[model samples]
Target chain A: MDIFRRNNVTVAGNPQGPTVVLAHGFGCDQNMWRLTVPALADAYRLVLFDYVGCGRSDLTAFSEERYASLEGYARDVVEVCEALDLRDATFVGHSVSSMVGVLAAETAPERIGSLVMVAPSPRYVDDEGYHGGFSAQDIDELLASLDSNYLGWSAAMAPVIMGHPDRPELGEELKNSFCATDPDMARVFARTTFLSDTRDDLGRVKVPTLVLECVQDVIAPREVGAFVHQAIPGSSLVTLDTTGHCPHLSAPEATNEAIRDFLAGLPR
Target chain B: MIHTDQQPEPYESQNEGAPDIQSHRDSTPDAAFAALLEDSAEELYEAAPCGYLSTLMDGTIAKINATLLDWLGLERDAVLGRMRFADLLTVGGKLYHETHFAPLLRMQGDISGIAMELRCANGDRMPVLVSSVVKYGESGEPLLIRTTLFDARDRRAYEEELLRGRKAAEEARRQAEADRARLQDALTVLQKSLLPDTLPTIPGVETAAHYHIASPDRLGGDFYDVFPLDGERFAFFLGDVCGKGPQAAAVTSLTRYTLRAAALHDADPASALATLNTVLHDRYTGSGDPRYCTAIFGILTPGASPGRLTIQLASGGHPPAVVLRADGTAAFLPTPGGLLVGVLPDAHFATAETVLTPGDTLLLYTDGLTEARTGADRTSLYGDEALLAFAADHAGKSTVDVIGALTDLLASFGDGLDDDTALLALGVPPLTAQP
Candidate 1:
């Protein structure tokens, strides 16, 4: 169905500049990257796409079995790269999509040049030696929240965007607006995004990676960012003063500046 | 699908935080209050912290905990005196209470492990577990039936997870079984893929071959190859591989090919199977896995007399071929002292000359038939005595008739078939019928 599509809004900065792909987090399609996208377009050719089973993509293309593992979604990233035939593409993914980009970079290092992860988590569930913020019990509670009242939860959660809700920033309103889609996709996407565990492949990423951590995100807490930084070797981590899960949504100017600086410093 | 009966003003619905009602504080205070006030019946039987309820024989609200009343949105008036217990249950719950629960309780005085739903005061349905017991009066009369219900929200979530896991496990198992059967069927189809749809009838030599696979669950171990070698010389081989399933089937296919290819190198039946033995030994030796076969390979040369032939037989570990004599006596022909076809680096095969006179029969079979057992009496297997008796009755029978009857008899044995069976019977017409 047309429901599975991502309305990719392509923007070009300088004709000679390098290419960069932007990925939005859960509860949002590519449209949520609007504020950040305009700022990045001045220096780079920006490409963006929504994850399958989200946005306007074909929902029929989404499979419970195939997508049971988010690795398949990473594989989709590689295929999208191939379809575009883009060379040395730098990937910038937010929240869960950040982790997905990490996996995609690990899977196809030759195609992707570098990774800019916004509040990534290598694994959400705790392991023996590592604590990735949330416990298994906490995840269960989140799923219970979805089951209890999926619509009410989005309504309750939409107001929980980054920065002050009374005087919401542009990025916050963009995120709050992103949460206004049909709720069924929200539930399915939540299971796909929040419940994923991709820790085992973090060390395999050869590409240079940078994880932007929000100092106080209830979802994908700062501890999870530390875990990701530790798991992925030679990876630079910089903590964001902006609170909440979406730094790009709350502090787009700083978020865009951070991403631009990271990309500008990368190897030609 | 859900309705709430409480009509409190939306403004007064903020919650007072209790230790248990922490998350409930995010909703309305009245909701948190209802949680406590409605849980009375649930608190009764459902082990303190949770809600519990019980109903009488005539579906009356006989017992309840304080926790449930807080959940039901009722003040005891609407539920205690006026409503029946069935009224509290959802449509599916009421149906289960009448059919599976009630009848089981009446017959066994106890019914446990039932999942149902409770209709709350606001018409909201809650999942619950109901277990009941019937208490009999001292006068031997049916008394009140006691039913206990525990709020099953957490349990329902847990059960749904378990059901998903169980369904996934069952699906994996079922797929494995299906793949096993599909492989065997594919092997059988591949085996038939090699065979000509109909066998070429040798002039002056009447022939019939039947291959029986005891179980369809895996590939059969038995294999037979019959084809013309050269002018006036016809060849055939009946062999049994050492095991079952895909591995043995692979060996059977390889052995058939090796025999066919090696026969072109040497016309002797003994030499053909000798090459097959070397191939099997080399493929499986020292791998901690051993593969072997038992076989009886034969060659036939037609004679001047109508429907007469000279047959040379070379056997390896397989049972001796049965010769049904013209005079109505069946005895195993001596081709003993032969090694298993594919065990050692070098193995020897023994050849014996046997003549099937007019009205005679040659029955070549795998050991599966002779080892079959019926009931506890393992002695009553498809033994030598029974086969001899069967041969006497089938005197002067055609080759086709003999093989068909044996096939039907093998099927009748059912689970008695422990291994694969292949039977090939060739009968020569009586001299009196010859023109």
Candidate 2:
């Protein structure tokens, strides 16, 4: 019941530059965008809000049966955008957040401008015709891990998301906004987002798209980024020469350069 | 294999055969041996197979073992002197322990073997069955509470299986209820589809019919319909199909439609039954599962002048119909013999003719009313004699009065009557009023 307890926490960037909505992955919060936000703050109006039951959002607003679906998170993106009156804003999504943006854009077509898909994956399960990585049984094993050892799975999953935990700052940054989520909600979302098959909706994105791939990312690899590109017609793909899934945190300068170049090429 | 901490004999007893060992060893070897014993105690605590720890009187963790530390991926500096016992539980575990576990332990002196969870340093939670005992020093002073924990992976899987089984059972129950409702709706639709919503009013006839559905939860097997074939002639039928539920309901639908269609082709009631018998026998021939039913059909021919009806009655393996005489006398019209519908390819239905004068009434009823078994001698069914007796007492009454009596009689049976009942009554009302 206490999970629905939430307060507004938004970080606004620049008005002169383009607006960018930053969405963090499953574990971390709005703070995970620290490196990327600094570089784009002057050039883009950055708006960030926590998914309810994660980060600073209300915990009581979370329901196991309702929040158990990624449809809630996708709806949250739409509501937050409408609540803030964000129009034609660029969507910067990481990991599963990239698919959330796609759904948000599909829900309200006019609210989106261009999508900067960073390490996006439509599904974590492999099917007969599609290879989204991992199998349905493999995902079951991951769910078992959470049910058996929630903390162990959460901590184990952190390094896999952050890539290299030996760098204390990156590890510590992820640790800051983690416990802010209801573990039950996280478990449901983990199963849903990673297990979903959204191959049908990729053709519906009306806006321009840019797929960003990490050259050495173990979680969302270059092959996945290429797959996303193949699904979306006329979409451009760029593989960054970074080693982690979270390149903005590890190699910000190169990441910033790629994003800035893509934004400059837009039809002003 | 490692006996590093075995207790030794007393120093004075050992020194009896040796030098003044107490003086020589008191400063060096004895002190070293004491330190070795202490170190061994620490090693045993750290390397125990099951997790063991000591909590302060206030519940702060004073010491923990390496077995648990390794499970949590936590070094000693992180937990040994820092976090409290409650800090190791997940958010839900913490809430449960505070609301349930802590109160129980405080009142009970010790609570043992309770299933709980410990959140590891790496954010993974370990399910464990925990036991705790509080130690008191001399003079009844509370010292420290020692706790032990065992892994519960296999137990968690078993619990999940039970939860799934319960969930599946509940879903199955809900589905069965839904299926029952769906069958009832289909029966109602089929029943209405066959019968006329309103009965036809002949020139001199006050017709009233009632269909009592004993059970709306399952499909009823009774049916009745009244239709005008043409000019001054009208046709009416009331029947009961054997059995109940979806299968019987299906046959009822087919039988009702066949009777209507065949009557349109020929006014001969025998020909109509012949058509229905062929349809049912042919459709269900190969399968040894045969369906049968009882029915009474009548064609009412109005008088050429007025105020009368020449009614032709045809009954199939059904009960004898009652005709209350116009002059306050009730009697049964002779319908010789008829075969049950669908028993033979050429089933015969006997025909009879009766003239309904001004106040004569014709009553048609299924076996549910006459065959209702009740009383201390439940072996006796409500036969035709009882129905005729009941009708004789209510003679000269309007059709509604007789129908109301029959309806009350149906309600009186309660659970004794199992089959569906349908009754149709046509009485010529004194030729004064018209509906």
Candidate 3:
């Protein structure tokens, strides 16, 4: 299989610079990195891709069993890295993708060298004394929320959102469009994201890691950020002065600066 | 008359002098109507039928109309510049706002008619349809968001009803499919009970048989079986009962067992068929739903000479059996003037006799094969002549080889062959000299 085509992988920025793969979390696709892409494109080789069942990735390749867990998404990352034959490339992941990057790094240690987790949460549902900011019932509510919004994600609204008369250029740039996914596939990804617990895998991280959290994110609170930081040995944590879960989109400058500093500090 | 004329002149002079009274009467109502229209713009915004709110770029409520505040049961002091737009939504709606709604609005600049629920101050959920547009600054940067909410209580209730109806229909369809699958499995097991699992091997003869079903859901009416009558003689029968499904299958089961029992009593092929005919006619003739079958019963006996067998067969309105020779010759053992079994109290059965030496075979089959439609238009019958010619081509082959070739031919017919078919080939081993 052509992993690049299957994953809808796109390469940009300085061709000779060290590679950095940007992975979006659940809900949105690769377009989530639009603001951060411009910040790192000058000196870093950037790789962006939509996971299977999201964005322009081939929907036929999506298997419910294969993608029922986080490992299937990690396999996509590993395959993309192998397809590009990258070694020691940094992986920048947002939200649920942060844990996906960890799995991919462990599976193919040579492919991904360092990690940048943006608003990362190892688990969404709280357990024991750990505060993941949500309960099992809350995750069920999130799934219900996803179900209620299925009408908005339907094809009837696609043309209205894509063909904005004021922004005609958007139609050309976003061919498969943004944040639109098959509702069934989105449900699987939602269940996998909100129900998964990856905290046990945090202590296994061997790469240079940087965890960036929003100062006041409802999805990933400060306690979760500190937990991930302390779990991964020698990992640095930076709290961006942002209020939402997506600091890269909400506070692009701070997120990019923290990412760039982490990349520069890594061994050549 | 003179006095009335004088009064009219005086009244006319008074009316001409009072024109200002008419203008005063017209201007009074117009002034009152104008006063009602004054200072109503702010009142319209606060008292509009639908809720309206404006938020900063990050969803901070910068402004809200009294109509929306009334719906939310929140005061202006508590809402304005204090709570974000998400704070007013239920938990599910808040997640929806963060994941799909906000991202789509950011990319498209406007999103409309999204179904969502708002949590009122009293903890009651209100279903509402919301539309939002970003108010951009002069530099094309987003400055704030303008939103409108319409009550969708009636629409939501109707949609819920439709959802329930659709879910019920889907469940019914799933249950029907599962029931069909189970029924087919039961029919297959019952059908197997009416036929032999494997043909019994004769002392010096090679035997092969094949049965094809037209539909998996309906039980086929065709059955065939081979069993040893005694130590030296073997009895075999192939037949098709009229009609299909469970009733015909029951008759097929009865016909098979009757033939076996009759053969044990009297090994004559004609006598066994006569017994079956008697049983079927006695059992079904009294019922309104009468059942009948066309069958070929045959007996194989060791001949006086070694490596030779004597075959006697009787047909009851069945197609003639074919005989193939090692000399590349084939012909039908025609048993004409036979009547369909169970149709009358006494039915005439046509009997034919033949001897099978080394390198000779006998074939028995029902009409499903010869009656199969063929050709491009599917208007032509395969017929007995075609079967004779096909058997001639495989005259010198073993029973297994001939049956295997015929199976392929049946498969090639595809949909053109839409009836249950049974084929049985019994052949003798060809003589070979020592190498």
Best by TM-score: 3
Give candidate 3 misplaced runs (Cα > 4 Å): A1-19, A36-53, A56-68, A75-89, A152-177, B1-41, B302-307, B429-435
Per residue, candidate 2 scores C-alpha lDDT tens digits across B338-383 of 8888888777788888988777889998988888887766667888
Index of the highest-DockQ prediction: 3
Expressed as tens digits, the lDDT of each residue in B1-435 for candidate 1 is 011122232123334223445555556568768667544322324345444444555556665556667767777666765666656766445433432344345445665545667778787878767676665665644455565667778877777786568658879999999998788778769666434456667765567887766666667878876788887787787878888887887888888888878877786878877888899899889978899999888887766775666778888888888877677677777788889977899999888767766788788888887877766654567776776677667756666777888888788788787777888876676777566
Candidate 3: tens digits of C-alpha lDDT, residues A55-80: 77877789999899999999999999
Candidates 1 and 3 compared: the better one by DockQ is 3
Compute the lDDT of residue A137 as modeled in candidate 3: 81
What local lDDT score does residue B305 receive in model 2, on the 0 to 100 scale? 64
The positional error of residue B306 in candidate 3, measured at the CA in angstroms, is: 5.9
> In order, what is each prediction's RMSD in angstroms?
21.3, 15.6, 11.3
Clashing pairs in 3: none
Interface RMSD of each: 21.8, 15.0, 2.3
Q: What is the C-alpha local distance difference test score of each model?
A: 0.68, 0.72, 0.85
Each prediction's total of clashing residue pairs, residues at least 3 apart in sequence or on different chains, is 34, 14, 0
Give candidate 3's whole-model lDDT.
0.85
